[model samples]
Target: MSEFNTTAFQPSLFILTGLRRLAGSRLWLGLLLSLMYIITMVGNCTVIHLVRKERSLQEPQYLFLSMLAWADIVLSVSTLLSVLKVYILGLYEIAFDSCLTQMFFIHTSSSVGSGILLAMAFNHFVAISKPLQYTTILTSSRVTRMGLAALLRAVALMTPLPILLKRLPFCKGRTLSYSYCLHPNVMKLACGQVRINILYGLVLVLFSFGVDSLLIAISYVLIFQAVLGIASREGQMKALNTCLSHIFTVFIYYGPLLAITVMHRISIRSSPVAHAVLGNVYLFMPPMLNPIVYSLKTKQIRTALRKSCKIQRS
Candidate 1:
């Protein structure tokens, strides 16, 4: 271990890289990112507001939607400043501790988002399969408990990441592949034995995203079985329509995620721009699109939005 101690060095700061190829077009890129950030914040905040203010939206699904909006807001804020700093202000260096903090929040919020999606699937399942027990099973207190549980679980799972990263010696260049810090990207910079880190990350993925996806799929299958048992075609159509917004949001959230995962593990030699763009999309798109999807697909939200707008105008 004497040899290890001699070479061990902790970086003071990490460099964040945006689209290197489009360095000259930073103004446009920054503007776009800024716009996306604004939309994400506004959209999610509106969802939260609508859920809280509108008495009609106090149901389990809308409450769960509000929880998801909160997650999206957290996720977007975690990345917003760092990304803007790099692209807009040309300030790419981030302090080591700050990077770790960002990574923690980002991962925690992401896990929470995934968990919320799972909870939503369960919500849909209960609403469809056991309509009578839905209110009894998912009372206000229980929904609140579920939300807190998701937050706590995410924190518990992601807490180890920053600690593990802090212990390792980072001798590689301080340049991060993306504007924000991620466990795998940070781990790649460590010169010390990181087998434990890699294994832990894989464990996180398997237990969180992997397990959540499986459960969500099972929930949908059960939902389908319930739908099929409905005697009338109109009832079946109405039931399926309730899931359209959620299904779209799920696909939007997971598509870039799957691509990013593939690029991280398999196509390691792809362009840095590809990695950066996909990272941005994974972080940005779901948050921006979720509220829109729900608002468009769910008539209630649209009506509430219009009512809110007219009230403001008056």
Candidate 2:
């Protein structure tokens, strides 16, 4: 761990610190992650398919749900090869270029997911507060632009990570903390000063999750305020129920993330297994569960699914 050098750079391979040679838990972890990957793909793909198939689902809310599904699919896919190789095939060494690519996609897709949640929150607000204007406000063209904007934001923020790390020499051992590459974990492996990388990583987290969470909270507050004014308990419950799925999705996506961050800061001495389990939970839970929550809770999605199933059977 010395200062920065002026020599020409050569890439080095890094190993993923997957499940530490559990005699049996290793097998179980592989099977569990495999199942999760399958479920995530199927669940999210179904949502996207249904949103495309049903005419009634062309509205803004379901449109955003489909985009979220797409982002989840990308996120899950970004980790699948590396994670499965580490856990199942016992392969650990990843080429530096590939690792950089993996890190870029992982961060960008996660950022895209956060942005999508913010979009969903705003969609819920518009639907709840200004029902009549929802269609006019969130036109299909506007929704398309929003999706593109989210992707662009992710790309802009994460583009610097691999480049910055490339410049620094990683005199520290080439071992990552998890089965996947994250900017925070990877940057810490660099030898020389990494204040710039650390600061930029912090900036990405704050802008992506911090700001989005705050906006979501504000949206919910306004939505609840409008719901409470509906004058009947049943009507109030109905209005509030519309937000339950989005709220739950947000919780599933961000709750474990926040918990992990808190634990990292406060319990610097926590067990490795605890961190591993929580990281897997944060990685796998939202993409696998989001579609299920929406399909079960949202009448339109459920009804469309039922009709689609009956048509296929007939």
Candidate 3:
């Protein structure tokens, strides 16, 4: 039998490019990403803490918000060290398995975030459409089930990524496009045929991100329809106001993802710096912005925060 092709070598280590073009501006980028990471951590943690400590925030909507916060925390943390290593410490060597693990968590947590947002959209619909039965429909137990299902779905859907990636040979250069591992970014560096990888990624994105976004949009459409049926404009506006935070959140979550997905397709002609910047934005913006948006827009969160502060001060 012919010996295995010598050219198809698997690398045990992958090098993260880590915004190489910005080597001249590493300090500013490092400081900026570091501060953003810090804020992401602080903001998400504060949301989780407030949700746990405050009785008024024990409702389904707030509970789902807390789940989103938890996912954001995990999503941000998954990439934190790797990014710091690349930007701050000038380290690019990540073990293959370590890179795979990071990729799994990054994608899984993002999926989890999407799932939680879908649940939140449903919560908004239920609250507006059937106010009298809002509590009854989204009881504590049901909310728990919803959250659990979201997480389980994320894990199940993302579990194949690392396994599939490990089976592929990587004779291609091992330099990754980003400081962290992404399924597409890593797969792009694999040698030989990668049609399966591309197809699988597209399928995953369709079933996960694409479906969730569509469902969330439909939920809002139904929500708007319900609001329009109300007799007075003020009442319609009030009902719609309740969904403002969720709408903002959906925007932040889906907008960057859509941009990144499109960016990957056009990456050949796109500026490398644009690719790096947008990918980081896609990862970091939602985590950093979600809590701030809620705190500013939602009355209940503010009220709960004030009460929590008073109790703690006492």
Candidate 4:
């Protein structure tokens, strides 16, 4: 296979690369990324462990929550590896095959995370709206099936992305401004028109992120309606409290996502630094915040963590 030379096509003013060049040193970025990765790993792992050990939380809701934690773990690890490869190893240029592999995992993890969130929403919906049927509707087998389905859907949806990207001729710039090989960044390198890649990406985004988000919204809407119909203020408050963690997490995940989309579409001269910063937030912020949200909101998780700590000390 003939590889395209990318030296001449390098952007003279790639904002992300320029920002990294000017913003002190790669050392700082490496240290920051490493610290964040460590925190994400510890926090998400703790959440997963607590959920797994707690007999009370061994239900469908917690099952999906654990899946979300696993997705975050995968995403955080892949992202950290890519960042370290660029900033610490000083290997900014990626081979075609390596880039494709990275893109595959990144997209797969993202899609899986979104799917897990939808499963969580459905769990909440059944628990709240159809309490009588909740147990029957979200059985252990059903939860397992949903999880497997989410994984398969994520992989199947993203399988074509890398192949499509590989088919494009990188006759243009090869230096991806960001630390990782994101779809948009890779698409920018195509010498030939990439209408197909863009269209396919948009379609996947709609099905994966956009559709999942909509379902989450609908789930919450119905949940809220149910809460409102309850006569007692205490009942309403309790119902709202159950969902606060999910709401916070959804916002953290989607806020930066929406910003990235708008920036990509509207901003002609967006800085690579801006994009990179937003990209990092979009990927890591939810994982970092999720544990905090759950810990603060759920007294059960906090008590479980304390008990787990005491057990570890013994």
Candidate 5:
């Protein structure tokens, strides 16, 4: 089959196929997705609010935490709107330009979120691995600059992606199989040679996602080594506890991401519903879980939440 004619070329087919297995039930999928989105919004907002309201939490670390929460909020809103359009409105067809726009923002948000996580990892490393330098290294001004730089890097790196996609001639099926415009899904529709596009997409995966993940792993390794060097048992325990929130958040973000990447690579004839569901999970699940994980795992956040609730009650 031509690249455009592959089974994966059909956008909604994967989604419909998966939904059919649920006894042809769109209502159930819609309901479940809606509930998930609501939870995601509430959880992310709570985190942002707690960080802002608590005076003690006003450190450089929590500031980054707030930015991460805001990114999740944006991602959740975008995903929810698109999913609702697909499930409720039955709108499956997307224009070429619209697809490019959606793909750009989705990719941008995903990349930016990953970058922010890396920043968080670095912050923890400084705090745990280099205690004396922590104040100088993570000053408010420096954190602000770093946060802006990460966002700018995401925009610069991903901006070319959509433009390159738009230049391709999509001679095959214009109808996207998935609800949103993902790079692979859209690339499948290109009538022209897509070798370059494929290579570029792979490069993006490697550099943006793969490289960042490796760096995070290395940072944690160093952190662990430093923690081990501490003479006091209580000090080691405290350092480990400090790293817990970032570790949990990284797992939540990277786990579904790796799953979706694998599915996209190996599942040649996967159903549209399967792709859609997985894509949604990869994009939104981390954001959804982040607030809950940090709130429950971090002592500071838990205390802030309790205090926020008490103040609200008054």
Candidate 6:
């Protein structure tokens, strides 16, 4: 608690404060998380496999979907061991260096997901606005480049966060509020100069989520404009129908995130249980639901899946 402790010291371990109120129910909670993890992995992997194998799914949007699926897989994997350690193994101690690496992947993958959503919005806009030029505009190489750009941008922004915390001396007790290490939560344990950490974290959020969400909104506006200009009612419905799954994915991914971010800012008066529940939702819901949404809404994906199943039987 000493602000004057200028002696830079790195704690050997950090404790995770994971659903402490539910200590008696770790077995049930662990089982639930395990099921969610399995579902998320299978769902996303199926999406990726279908997109890669199906000739009918070689379009720009499906390619972006596979990218998002990959990101979701990474995000879920990064937290799997740590989460299971807390819930299943009754272990809360994480090595400091391991904590930093975990946070790095978690933040990077989440940001990449946001970036992919932005790319998807752009894909929809182009397809709806200029159907004739859609394939020419979003060529395969171009889609690959967009996915790579998202990953690179996330790495550049997040690489400094752990390094910044590494330089500071963590005089405060090394207990993180969530099951996983987040930059904001980890930085709070440092007693040394952290104004830069706070400022940079804020900047990172604004630049990544804020800017991406705004651009996505703008893209949708343009898409709706294009939809409105369609000559027939059936045409408008068909065009808008294409976006239903992505729109639902966006809501599942960002809604809990935005809510959790707001709660963190005012968490002094918030209940820990609320944080625990919402945090899990923000992490687990999107990955688990994305494939299901697409399978149910997209005719091509459903048809391809059925064909694949029938082929497997034969």
Return the TM-score for each candidate structure.
0.97, 0.95, 0.95, 0.91, 0.89, 0.96
Q: lDDT per prediction?
A: 0.90, 0.86, 0.89, 0.79, 0.77, 0.90
lDDT by residue (tens digit), candidate 4, 154-223:
9999999878866666656556667777777778777755798888888988888999999999898889
**Quality of model 6 by C-alpha lDDT:** 0.90
Off by over 4 Å in 2: 1-11, 264-266
Q: Which residue pairs of candidate 2 clash?
A: none
What lDDT is reached at residue 28 by model 2? 78
Taking the tens digit of each residue's C-alpha lDDT, what string does model 5 give over 181-288?
Answer: 677777776756678888888888998989889999999999999999999999999999888888888988888888777777788888767776777678667888
Q: Model 3, residue 291: what's the lDDT?
A: 95
lDDT of 1 by residue, 154-223 (tens): 9999999999988888887899888898888888888777888988998998899889888999999999
* Candidate number with greatest TM-score: 1
lDDT of 3: 0.89
Ordered from best to worst TM-score, the candidate numbers read 1, 6, 3, 2, 4, 5
Model 6 worst lDDT run, 10 consecutive residues: 1-10
Candidate 3, residues 51-110, lDDT tens digits: the string is 998888888988999999999999998999999888888888999989999999999999
User: Can you tell me which runs of candidate 3 are displaced by over 4 Å?
Assistant: 1-8
Least well predicted 10-residue stretch by lDDT in candidate 4: 10-19
